[model samples]
Target: MTEQRPTLADVARVAGVSRAAASRAINGTYGASEAVRRRVREVAAELGFEPHAVARALATGRGSAGRRERIEILIVDPDPEAMSAKPFYGRVLNGAMRALGDQDIALEVRRVSALPVDDTDPPFGRVLINVPGAAGAAYARRGRTVALGRSAPGVAFVAPDNDDGGRQAAVHLVATGRRRVGAVFGPATPCANERKAGFLRVMSGAGRAVASADGDFTRARAYMATRELLEREPDLDAVFASCDVTAMGVLRALRETGRRVADDVAVVGFDGSALAEAADLSSVYMPVEDEAESAIRCLLDPARPAPARLPTRLAVRGSS
Candidate 1:
């Protein structure tokens, strides 16, 4: 005979808490203290208790005969090839899937060239990426929306500490005795700007001047920008690429100009992606997967506040 699966009642009884309290704790709703919530969750885990989706929906007053809860990931990138080409998108999807493990929620991904997303059918929740904070905030009016980076007060967000990552890079370069520094700067987005600001702050304090060129977070643009920066600063001994993809372009330019990496010209990149690992490049490692997971958790339970910002650290490799 098959043993019956553990139920919420079993969890509540074992935890020495009321069933109502157990439900609130499991659902991340109000009325449950932190200690109670933790204890209930631990008890539930021990018993292998899994909540029934239909029951949960009925309890929350969101259930219908044939309807299941759905969450959408809205990406605001003009490029049609972003989903396949960008590693960041893949990482985000992986994290979201991890957070939604064994749940009955439906996941949908949609890419729009620009926003105000005009979808008439709003999902139960939404995750916004590559959208401005003010623009992303507008979606909160329609449904529960979580932004991937810093957003306006009305919207919740999960962001990396971009400023701190940049500061770390600057210190690393300076400590290595690099004086003539050049930079490939990302486009004027909030996260990119914060990184630039932090890097500049440390550079100014160290009495170093940075020669910079603009990059649009693309390999082609970064390649052209690297060439342009090299032309303007021929004696540059080190460079900081805004991201790992951009670092590939910087490496190519250096090779073409007969500059030895790490020996003659040190190079540092961001994102700590597979590209960086394969190339043995130094980079700032941000918890992209964790950020995505946190965003999904916020969507699952509106009561939970989205994490303000995740942490970042420098990973020193052969390129630097």
Candidate 2:
């Protein structure tokens, strides 16, 4: 017969702490003083006590019948506030929250600059977003992890078809008879790089040379890049921005340069965000909400067909 597992009471006794304190420390719950927490954990480890995931979930009200598991949406950004300020990321969160509404599951949002180097198990599965390089890989190694965007090798993810969106943007401009095109591409992220690649592929296929500049997926950076592109190609008849926020800057720069929208230069953007709608900018409409929902599903059920890429469509407006 298997040896009986050490109980929370055993841990508490060994640490000379109350059972409540042991529970709090083991669960990383609030109200346990730092010294008590440390002592409890040490005693539990010494006793070979491992907190069962299901029991912990039940204690936290996340394992009741008809209720689903708790999950975390980890936004891997050092500056979470700045990241959330972007309309695209905000919409992703809104979509995730909507999908979670009144569901059997509980959701938590966390922002971390880097992955912790600890043997402790995470309380819940995680949906990683905006994490890149080795940090993303480290999180992927943890069980039951899914990504909100394309991630490192062997990681499951849900994201928009960014390359297709870029192609659609190019086709729209070309069909509208706009040549001498300029493009404002975003940073080195996978989505940004894919969009740029697709746009350039189509432009080259159409025998049109593209004047391109890089932006950090921000209005200010795009604004500066647009100025450079315009100066380099004065007769540029159209501009394709990697994302809607960057497009706002492109529009501003065009206006400052006394260029008329659609007549002098057509403008296209991505993300189909509210800003694009307000500016009447033609954009690629990606299903951000669907992506988020799918990500949650993937995390909950790893056996599900995963690494899904949602479709995109062109929303034509006055700008193009």
Candidate 3:
């Protein structure tokens, strides 16, 4: 009989750790301390215990050895309710799912306030979305990681062309003969910051004074901000919202103040979401789905080139 091949169990036994720990270490998963991971990997190598990709593929019915992999999309939002309430979340998931089409790899979304404190079994990779810079740094240490929407130091990322999107909105407003504009900028995330910068840059260049207010990227906050903006600049004839959801709030505020959209205040927003279409709001359309797809590709292929900045275009509608 052929000599028995050493299994993960044997590696775990020799490493004096649980099979799960051994697996996690071998897979470069979180949970295991660096010391433990190094020890387990050393033991695995000594025992000649190699993971069987072909067997895993057969068991999972995946097309290739890589198909059995699992990638997680981590949305670092503390408020689950508010995060889910946004239409952009669903749109992002839709794009991610479409990008994953027919792949045997599992894709999951997880919400967390911060990176996991313990090294649990890590997935094949992770896509970080809406995470803070510190949290992103922590998660990237675990394994292959890709950031969506914002770039982190020493990590791969895919993001929409936010600066250009902002420029597009400003150009549209200017072309439409609107002056005395106001802006409802989103939360202080990098994406939002870029959009704000782009819009402000163009507006400043055009020699237009813009009344601006900060919003938490929520409808209620935007509504309040819009009210304040109008109060500060009652003669404002155009408003640029950082996102479609915020744009909705802006619309409500305008209506309550008896300002007709387009005629009284040409409104523009970002994200090119369904809400924008339903409300006939002109928006900068970013290719979110393509970004998601590119993120996945980056995670799967380590050698894949850095993702380029996805393009954004203005979707003109009745609102602008």
Candidate 4:
């Protein structure tokens, strides 16, 4: 007698979950928590349940004859030229590529000036970079979108502990005996705001006041902002740059102004990019590649909730 092939129902029965939940878990979609997904997969493996490819394709709205499954990475950057100058995005792409190893999925990269309003042909999933938290919610109506940083409620995202990173920067500067501190703040994005807030909170707690200037997350802007900050607070003993690129600008500004780094004014930057290591600048290191990998995994197996915040630490260098 031919042995009947194990079914999803059998797996669900063993896992003690509803048929719908079992299907969701197996298909790696939302509505199934990590625990549920794990149990379902384990049961499926024990029961030797194999999902029919055609049925899966149909369920996911990708028919066998349909276009290949693809994940689109939408970069919301106004200045296209900035893409080449930024190392952070390169790291993100590298991590995404790593996470996609041997997966039957294609990746598409696109730079957009603004979020699209049209509900055009959406890809299988989307990875949003440098987008504001408010604008992220709109993508929920489009398709499965996983943002790289903090996003509005109900939007799936993966991000580092920017606030904690900022706090670490403040603590380091203070412990290093820097009294008068200045900050080059990034653009008014959710992640940037969080970083700034955390820094400010620590400084305030220590009874220290920080003078700040706005930078557009660019070297040029940060250079100008740092110069302006110096003009406002000539006795600035330490500066916190929002990112490594911005830190480069701050360093350049300090050098051009006859201010010696680590001796005259200690500097600490965020992002912990290669730029920081090359310059030997003290920085708060955030695992950007790991965050990117988590984001990719979330898009692939959306059944599990993404991690709210990844760990961050301070990498002390000569700059501080």
Q: Which candidate number maximizes lDDT?
A: 4
RMSD of each: 7.1, 10.1, 7.5, 4.3
- lDDT (C-alpha) at residue 99 in model 4: 88
* Cα error of candidate 2 at position 146, Å: 1.0
Angstrom error of the Cα, residue 308, model 3: value is 0.9
- The residue ranges of model 4 lying beyond 4 angstroms of the native Cα positions read 1-66
Off by over 4 Å in 2: 1-70, 77-84, 112-121
Backbone clash total, candidate 3:
4
- Model 1 lowest lDDT segment of ten: 59-68
TM-score for predicted model 4 compared with the true structure: 0.83
- CA lDDT for candidate 4: 0.88
Q: lDDT by residue for model 2 over 96-176, one digit each (tens)? A: 777666655567776777655673747457777777856667877766677777888888888889999999999888888
Candidate 3 segments whose C-alpha is farther than 4 A from its true place: 1-68, 113-116
Q: How high is each candidate's TM-score?
A: 0.80, 0.75, 0.79, 0.83
Question: What would you estimate as the lDDT of candidate 1?
Answer: 0.86
Candidate 4 lDDT over 1-320, as tens digits, reads: 99999988898899999987788789885446789989999999988899999767765545757756788888988876766888888898889989888666778888888877775788878888887767777876677899998778989989999999999999988888889999999998878898999999999999899999998888999999999999999999999999999999999999999999989999999999899999999999999899988888888766667986999999999998
Clashes of 4: 0
List model 3 lDDT by residue over 1-320, tens digit each: 99999998899999999886677678764335678889998998888888888643444435453445578888866555755667766766777777667766688788776656775878878888888887787788889888987766877789988999999999989888988999999888999999999999999999998999998778888999999998889999999999998999999999999999989999999999888999999999988778887887777555567677899999999998
